[model samples]
Target: MLKQYSFEKTAVQSFDAQTTLALKTEDLQVFYGANHAMHDANLGFPKNQITALIGASGSGKSTYLRSLNRMNDGIATVTGKIWYHGVNINEPNVNIYEIRKHIGMVFQRPNPFSKSIRENIVYALKANGMKSKADLDERVETSLRGAALWDEVKDTLDKSALSLSGGQQQRLCIARSIAMAPDVLLLDEPCSALDPISTVKVEETLLELQKQYTIIIVTHNMQQAARVSSQCAFFHLGHVMEYTSTGTMFSNPQIPVTQDYIAGSFG
Candidate 1:
């Protein structure tokens, strides 16, 4: 049985005035039927930086990440505002498809389309009216390179994506997401299925991509969060218990609950 834990709400941390926010959520809440899955979450993601959401199982980290780009649509009731570029994207009539293009997501598992490696990256572009062959080719290479998979797969672009190893496939999925040129990328436990080497590669890719994209990642591995993210948020029992810089949060947590969790007393 899981141990039930209660925590007091601590103020979410903030970046300095000069740091620009790429995205933010205001009073966010999510519900599955009558069960409240996430509490009111107010958080900001600084531009060109990585922010990791850390929590144990069923702590609402994934719930909050999915709600950012309206992935919870048709499945749950998501309330509050997701602010991006001065617009509240959670409005009732907003175009979720359009919003998702600007804020792309990679799932917990590596889900490559059953198509050629090249096709997997270009399919979305073609569906969205990218008809120029030269542009598509350029995008394919650029995206793969951005994911750090170019040299290995450049010679086999015509081969089936499934032919690649697990780590390669996951990086291909990252390339697919990058092809769309999103302003923010959300990854949910992207390395859980990968081996140690693969996990390190993915972590390195994220660190490099942070220079060009605002990244929000959900990671169960506290070490990964400490390595890749500039800031971290600790969630517990549907509430954001604390948010702070990774260094401070790990070295000297402000909340008792955070300290306990980091110390491995309880998840």
Candidate 2:
């Protein structure tokens, strides 16, 4: 049996007063049937910046991330306010599909459709009623470029997406997401399955994209979080143990549990 340690909740540090919040959660909680998977998760994601949620397995970091975009709608019971654009998206009457159009998500594994690279990027646009050939063409190029894949696939647009390597396919999926022009991007362990070289590419792509999109990523990789995120939140047993700037969290963790986890004493 694993030992359970109780930790005092540390106040989540606020961003600069001049910083604009892209999204924020208030008293968020998640449950799977009867299992309370997350506690009151109050955190804000700064506009056009990257925030990394880090923790060991089953610590509820992913659960909190999923709630941001209501990805837990069908699988879990999520209660609280997810605020975006001055609206509480957690309301029962809120249109989830509409909310998703503004907040896109990428999963742990790369899941590209069994279509051509061009089709994979254009599919969502078409389904959303985009019909102009010129507009679609421009969007395809920009989205792919945004994902750092246009240079390699420009000459092979008609090739099957499955024909690409795992990393490329993941980038293609990101292209698909960005083609929707979402303001916020949520990534869940996107690089966990990739080789180191591929991981670097994805990280670079993220750094570039943050110029236009607020990003929230759930990752177990401490080094990757340090490299890509401006802020970091540590979760422990369904609660936020500490949330602060990435540099501060790593260099001088105020919470002993955070220090222990960062030091590899325990997770």
Candidate 3:
């Protein structure tokens, strides 16, 4: 049997309109050899709301996050149905490129390729089949402005992306992700590595972006989750101990596990 998270060949499950959800995992069970990283997980993610997946370090936050875009496809084996709109993305008939086009992701670390700042964002537009130079320039500017980094790097469009500070690089990454004009954004702890100012910029950028695209964030920072998310889902040992509004999850937790987790009892 093949295992997930091996970086071999990630498995994919694509779902489109008529699916009733921006994303859904129906009994998603993943294994890494004998270790059951994610149990029979079921979830429905709404469209256009900031949904935060908060949990301890190895609770499958990033695993589930990658599963959303079939970023797990590189692993040799994976089983389960992940519906996007209404179709199973794991099915072979669906278009992976098209599915990924609608779903964009940012990693825990800001991984920008060795390219000019302008080239980074433009590259995504080009991949999406935008060829006109004027159109490309407009999107590049727009995305950078949207990420709240345009004014800082606008004058250095041709500068190397590697030259920017950590926060700026992260914002650049966000710019590149949104340049694709995706309907949804998946962030895997995008602020864990940033300074306070940089983190604030990313959070602000998310606020600006979510008005148009549904956002799903996997964050360990309780404050970050508490401050930015409208809804919260707490996972523990592959189980969702609690799922509710931020207010309820924080102030009026319905589950003892949720209350303990919120109080920093056990991971």
- Scored by lDDT, the top model is 1
Q: What TM-scores do the predictions have? A: 0.97, 0.97, 0.89
TM-score of 2: 0.97
Q: Residue 184 lDDT in model 2?
A: 99
lDDT of 3: 0.81
Worst 10 residues of 2 by lDDT: 1-10
Q: Is candidate 1 or candidate 2 better by lDDT?
A: 1
Predicted candidate 1 versus true structure: per-residue lDDT over 80-160, tens digit per residue: 889999999999889998988899999999999999999999999998899999999999999999999999999999999
lDDT of 3 by residue, 1-267 (tens): 211222222212233455445778887877777777776566777677788999888888788878778788766245789977678887767787888888999999999989999999988778768999999999999999989999999889999999999999999998998899898899999999999988998999898887888899999999999988977888776666566777778898766666677898766
Minimal lDDT window, size 10, model 3? 2-11
Error of 1 at 76 (Å): 0.9
Candidate 2 C-alpha lDDT tens digits along 56-170: 8999998888888888988999998888999999988999889998999998999999999999988989989999999999999999999999999999999999999989998
Look at candidate 1 and give me any clashing residue pairs: none
Per-candidate local distance difference test: 0.92, 0.92, 0.81
Model 1: runs farther than 4 Å from truth? 1-6
Worst 10 residues of 1 by lDDT: 2-11
Using TM-score as the yardstick, the better of models 2 and 3 is: 2
Model 3 segments beyond 4 Å from truth?
1-20
